[model samples]
Every structure is written in structure tokens, then in C-alpha cells.
Target chain A: MSRQASFGAGLWGGALALLLTGCQAGLRPIAALNQPLSGLGDSQSPSLNSNWLALISSRPGSRAQVQLIDRLRHAPVPLPGLNRPDSLPISVAVDQRGERLALVRQRDDRSELVIHRRSLQASQVVPIEPAGVPQRVSLSADGRVLAVEVSRGGLWQVDLLELP
Target chain B: MACTAVTALGLSGCSLWPLRRQPAAPAGLAAESRQQPALSGDGRLLASLVDRGGRTTVLLQERRTGRVLPLRQLRNRQPHSSPSLSWNGRYLALLVQQGGRRQAVIEDRATGQQHPLFLPADQEPQQLSLAPDGQSIALELITGGSRRLQVFSLAAMLEPDRAPGLLESGGGPPLQP
Candidate 1:
């Protein structure tokens, strides 16, 4: 009957594009992780690799997602396009051997910096360097120096002495 | 009838292609006063930066007789802001860090007084620009190994012998500091 309905519509359009690119790595990372050295809300910040985690969310509709937790196959993909489309993810940097990844985008007076290639499927868009209000995003201990500081402004014209 | 008008225009183009929802945090502002509002430079004043759980704040309002100023470095954590305003809003510029040190504050909310610009000890200034009757300020420093582009004078830190054209040629020797 018409080749079995075109092979079931090509296997349901390749299983809905692999279920929308396998929905942001569902969640699984716990090799003794405890991260909590301050910071709790307002759409979060402070996540360096493991246990330096800090993620805040304002919720209101929400838009920002990046999942990369393969602590040896615990699996949790989705890191492509590195969370664009309103890209309000603010922070995530784990370079210096943990493979490579740096992502941040802060609104209200601008701030954008991206660097990808952690692999959860990549096709492009992995450019870096464009500081603009970044405070503490260091990567050197043999990762080739990259530090930023714009800590946060408006309370006495501070830019944290202009770090490098 | 022309094939039922092309099957009702292909099911109305599939219900006019998805996403089209709006009507949020309006009708009298308060999803925390509609988030980002900053309206200084002669609009009378309005600023924003709020965070609930991680506790962040900065709201110098008065956009037409409403009066509100709870901007003491936005109390209780969650800083990392840059809420500026000083073309006639009286004065306000920020950068308040924690932990690895960082300080550069300025708030004059018509004589509320606040001024400090001190940074040196592993510089980490990731951009800041303000110049327009606000007394000059522009920085993008990153100390150690030259990555500077500074220009400031809120009556301080402008002494490259008092503005040697705001010092230039600050480069070389930094492949990654």
C-alpha cells in the first residue's frame, strides 16, 4: 500500500529529529559533586566544571539551556547552538583541559562571550573573545590565559580595576 | 469550489505558524516592575536590577514622582551589575565585586555621595564606557601584560600626569595573563 505508507513516513520523520535533538541531556551528573560557595538566585552564575555550580533562574517564561554532563557516560547532551535564541544563560566555563566550553550572555547593558566545542553535536558557531562585563572567567594553568572582570556595575563606577 | 478553497488555505497555514503569545507583566507593572527599565539622562530617573532568590537589588526610581532609592550596592549579594545613569539623573555608575576583590563605585543621587575607583592587584575590568557630562570614564583593562584602554577622571585615576592625552600605546607582552 504505497510502499507501506512511505515506510511509515520515513520512520516518523526520523523519530521527530531524534526527539528534538534529544532534549537537552535530561540530567545526570553526580560523582560526588556538591558545589555551593555562594550565589543562589536571579538566574544564576558561577559554574566552573563540577561542584562550583551556581545557577539562578528568573523563570518568567525562561530561555537558556546548555547541558553537558558526560561524567563518563552518565549522559546529558544538548550543548549545540550553545543556547541561543534569547541566550540568557549568563555563565559556564570549563576550559583548561575539561575539553573546552565557555558561555555567557548577560542582558541589561550588554555582555556576551561564547566558546564551544564540548561536543553534543556541533556544526558551527563557536567563536570566542568579546568580554564586555565579565568578571572572573579565568582559564590558565596551562589553558592559555583568559580572565575577565566587569564584576557588576553601578555602585561607584567600578569595573574591578580592569582585569586582564 | 476550487477544491474547497485549497483546503481552507492549507488548514490556515497550520494555524498561522505557532508562537504568538503576549500580555505578560503589563497592565500596571509588577513582575518586579517589568524587569529592566533604566531611563535616566533627563527622563527624571529610573533604574533596575533585581533578583529574588540570590538577592540582588538596585532600583533608584522616581520617573515622575514615585520616589524610591534602595541602591546601597544592592544589599545582600547578587551584584555584578552595571546600572548607569548620569547625564542629569544626578549620578550613578557601578561595579561591585566580591571574593577576589573589585571596587569602583559612584552614586550621587543628588548628594547621596559615593565615589571610589581603585583597582590594581590582578586587574579585571571587562569593559565599561561612560562619557556625557558624567565626567569621563572608559575602561577595558585586564592588567598584567598590557590589555588596557583606560580613561577615567571622576577627579581621580586620570593622572598619567593629569591626562597625557589619557595615555596610549599600552600594549605588548601578554599572550595570556
Candidate 2:
């Protein structure tokens, strides 16, 4: 084959190879959860560790609830005493092992922080005092650190809390 | 030789350009009235604000299944507002107005608990963001029509029963005269 022709053919082949590789990377699926989760509340604000997925959900005629699902079982793990008929569960964060939970409970008059440990079976309430009102709450993966978003005097601020 | 040089350049250009490109659109997310969508750290889930009939709600969806994971409408019966999600999708923060006053609230999505963080008496919080390590939030404060930026640490205000050393929490002891 002529040298120029050979070079052209090689270039075409290389371009095709490159194109294929790029297509594969772009099309690769990122999720393996094939089965659609059914009968769960419409989830919002999801936080995940390796084994657990947590979110806020609501059912018809009921207040908002926080749902923690075990990824392996795809079932809800009930968080007793965390939900009240009148109050709403607005946010949730679970520790690495899904053992510790940091959450926000909203009542008509005020909202409060409830940190609970599954193993300890104890829930602690931290008064978000002095700060204005809590907007968002998050916990470090280790469950030792807490972050709260607060609104005061018509402005927004984030408050960091260290839990014992 | 010229032909060889051209081929080499062509090959180099090809290497620089990706062969396949993924769609820019997020997987399976339908076009809706949703605004301010935040993806999880892993990009497997998305949280956004949806406005319907003058009501605003925060929605979460699993990217792969196109299934809307059940989330309670965070703004239902509350004021219509936008919220920011933490990088890990663990925390959601937003503004709420009650009794003619505005405030910020944080929700731990995992446990469905909500807490109120108090702001200064007269200053107003304009917007806020969570720090990546989930330790603090950068907040924009507005007072008397002027704006200021500030960083607030989670460890500083959340005084637990036991105190971790200042070095450990990266916060120094309170400054006193």
C-alpha cells in the first residue's frame, strides 16, 4: 500500500478505537439497584453510608417521617420514639455503622435536635438555643460532629455542634 | 515524512479527545419545575426543589431506577423556600418564616429529625452552604440591607457534655478578656 494511504488507514482506525472507548465510559451505568423501591414514601434529602440509606418521607394523612432503609434487605428500620403524630421528622443522618443517628424534630412552636444511638438505646436532645432557628442539620460520619443551618434576623447561618 | 508527522499529530489529537461522551443530562430525571437540584456525593441520588401550584417541596430521586424515593414534602405547610443539601446528602438546610420572622432549619434526612439553629436577634441569614467535611457552613448574613459572609463551625455551638480538645475539633477556646 502507498505510504500515505497506509497512514490514512491507521489514523482512521485509531480514531475509531478512541471513539469506542469514550462511548463505553459515558454509557457505563453508575447504579446497580435494579429493582425499583416500592411502597416507600417519596424520599428527599438522602444520606448514605455503605449499608444504609436515610431520607425524609411522608405518607398520606400523616406527618412527615424519616425512613432509614437497610440496603441489603431494602427494608425500613423503624426509629421508635423519633416520630410523633403532631411533630414532623424533617432530616436524618446515620453514622458509618448505622448505629448512631442525628435528627431534627419539628413541632408547632419550635424544633429540637435528637441524637440517638441504637446500641445505647438513648436519645439526647440538644437545645438549639441562642441560635435563631434550625434550617438544616447534619452529622459527621463518626456521629461526633453536628452541623446546623440557622436563620436569624432574616439572614442565614450554619451552626456547628460537637456532641459528647 | 510529512505524512508521518501528520499522522502523529492526528493520533495525539485523538488521544486528547475522548471517544465516547456520556449524556450531559442526569439519568432518568424528568424535566420538571424542579430547581436547585443537588446530587449526592456518589451521584446516585438527587435532591431538588419542586414548585407545584404555588407550593414548594423538596424531592429526592434514585438516578438508576427513576423512582422517586418517598420524602416528605419538607416545605409542606411551611413557607415556600429553597434548601441546600450537604455533599453526602445527609443534611438539608433551608429557610423558614414563622410569625413574621425568618429562620434556618437543619434536618438529618436519615432519622427524620429537625432542629432549629438560632441566628442573631436582628441580622438575617440570606443564604448558606455546608462545608464538604460536614463540619461547618458558610453563611451569608444580611443586616440593615448590607451583606456579610461568615463561617460557623458545628463544634463551636454544639457543646456536648464532654469536650474534645480544641486541636481535635479545630476550634480554639472561647476568647475572653
DockQ of each: 0.01, 0.01
What is candidate 1's TM-score for chain B alone?
0.29
Q: lDDT for model 2, please.
A: 0.54
* Predictions in order: chain A TM-score: 0.26, 0.74
lDDT of 1 by residue, B143-176 (tens): 6643433444443312111111222224355455
Question: Which candidate tops lDDT?
Answer: 2
Q: What is candidate 2's lDDT per residue for B1-177, written digit by digit as tens?
A: 533543343322212111111121244433343444444433445555555666666666653454666646355545535455554566666766655776666666667756555655776766554433344444445666544434444533222211122232436776575
Q: lDDT by residue for model 2 over A1-164, one digit each (tens)?
A: 69999999999999977765543332221122212223543445455544566666655666677777675675678777566677777667675568777777787878766777776666666555454666566555555555555555554434444444
The clash tally of candidate 2 reads 55
